[model samples]
Target: MRQHGLLTLGAGLCAAAALGLAAPHPALAAPDSCSYTSPTHQPTLTHGDTGAAVKQAQCLSNMWGGEPPKLPLDGVFDSVMLKKIKWIQGCHGLPQNGVIKDRTWQVLYHPALDCYDPYPV
Candidate 1:
């Protein structure tokens, strides 16, 4: 058996067709999987670092998905993460030192849609 009278909607009928029944709301956008922290609070992260900050960097780095593959989000800055960081840095014309500092943070947060430099094999 099933209930029928329990189907109550919005108090103001807000759940109209505009809510995707007929068309998608133009202003709505789903958030991505990554989003580890506020951009302003990014710490100076380097290899061997671990914790939320490292996780943040890893998450953001995954946003730049390319040749190397997405990181594990384990918060450990291993050699693989280092190479990816260097590639991202190089793409932004920053020094490819494999250090996730201020400028690197900027790129990680706002990565270019396309990178001219190919990911190294």
Candidate 2:
């Protein structure tokens, strides 16, 4: 299996070189439901933050559903959002800190299909 993977990787690299490319570009997260600025450009959000970005984060987090209860989408980062964020971080194997940093944002945009951790109370 390792040898096959290595061969595949080598073939991919050779193909990329032949095509005059560095490597394959990864797929970007799907279009989000919110109309706010693209999530990639939004600033980090944490406790006490509020605005379109917060609304955007809330909306994305809601997609996780039972991983954490859905948020209000009210553009306010309150306790509920904090708790939900922490659970989401845990599900993604990220720091359990409830801050919406870059990695957190990425996970929010692209959550796992199914989290292995049991839902938080």
Candidate 3:
């Protein structure tokens, strides 16, 4: 009976290992849905918003390059993101306000850093 119980326990452990019960599977891990691809429509993103779109905006903002380090890929529009947006807007000769409007999206997607005078730092 003791030997039979040991065999059963070993089998159960092996099954658990095979089933990946010991650690999280790749599929079980959180998806990279936060990586924003492109703006379908001009969704006005303000400082208080949070979602994949915001994350996408952050990613685009990072493409500006130089000065402040790249923002995290997390989907939150906090003050740091707001500041970055404002800086980008300034660089693109848009209003200094941190609001991501239609023009802001345009500048983000197509950064014409030379067209408008660089916003004062």
Candidate 4:
């Protein structure tokens, strides 16, 4: 009788542990609903216009809540601001190229990139 009880208890604990490992915690689970959108269009990166540079600068400025480094929007790519952009990319699981790619733009524009709702009903 004692052995049978111990066996049952051990099996129950093992099952509980398996379930815990298989199931995601509430915090880790995806939200039931979210509102987000991707960038409709890419920034125009003209040879001398440097749209990517301008967008990156704007994003950094918005993130830091201040004026960004006065870098030329001519494809020069500011090293300092590039580093900050890379950091932002890293945090958001982006390519970290320091250049504003489409994915980066999407994240920059949308508040809920991870939980975007293409067509909210």
| Per-model lDDT | 0.68, 0.71, 0.65, 0.42
* Candidate 2 vs 3: which has more TM-score: 2
Comparison by TM-score, 2 against 4, better one: 2
Model 4 stretches astray by more than 4 angstroms: 1-39, 44-61, 64-76, 111-121
lDDT for position 57 in model 3: 81
Q: In lDDT terms, how accurate is model 1?
A: 0.68
lDDT of 1 at 5: 27
After superposition, candidate 3 runs with Cα above 4 Å error:
1-38, 113-121
As for lDDT, the candidate ahead, 1 or 4, is 1
* Model 2 poorest ten-residue lDDT run: 22-31
Question: Tens-digit lDDT track for model 1 on 18-105?
Answer: 3322211112211244556665677888899998889888877776644455678898999999988998888789999998888998
User: What digit string (tens of lDDT, one per residue) describes model 2 on residues 39-118?
Assistant: 66758788999898898888777766443346776899998899888877887789999999898988877777545354
RMSD of 4: 15.7
Best by the lDDT measure: 2
Off by over 4 Å in 1: 1-33
Q: What is the TM-score of each candidate against the true structure?
A: 0.69, 0.69, 0.61, 0.38
- Residue-level error in angstroms, candidate 3, position 21: 52
lDDT of 4 by residue, 25-51 (tens): 123212222112123544533222445
Residue ranges of candidate 2 with Cα displaced over 4 Å: 1-31
Clashing pairs in 4: none
Clashing pairs in 3: none
lDDT for predicted candidate 3 compared with the true structure? 0.65
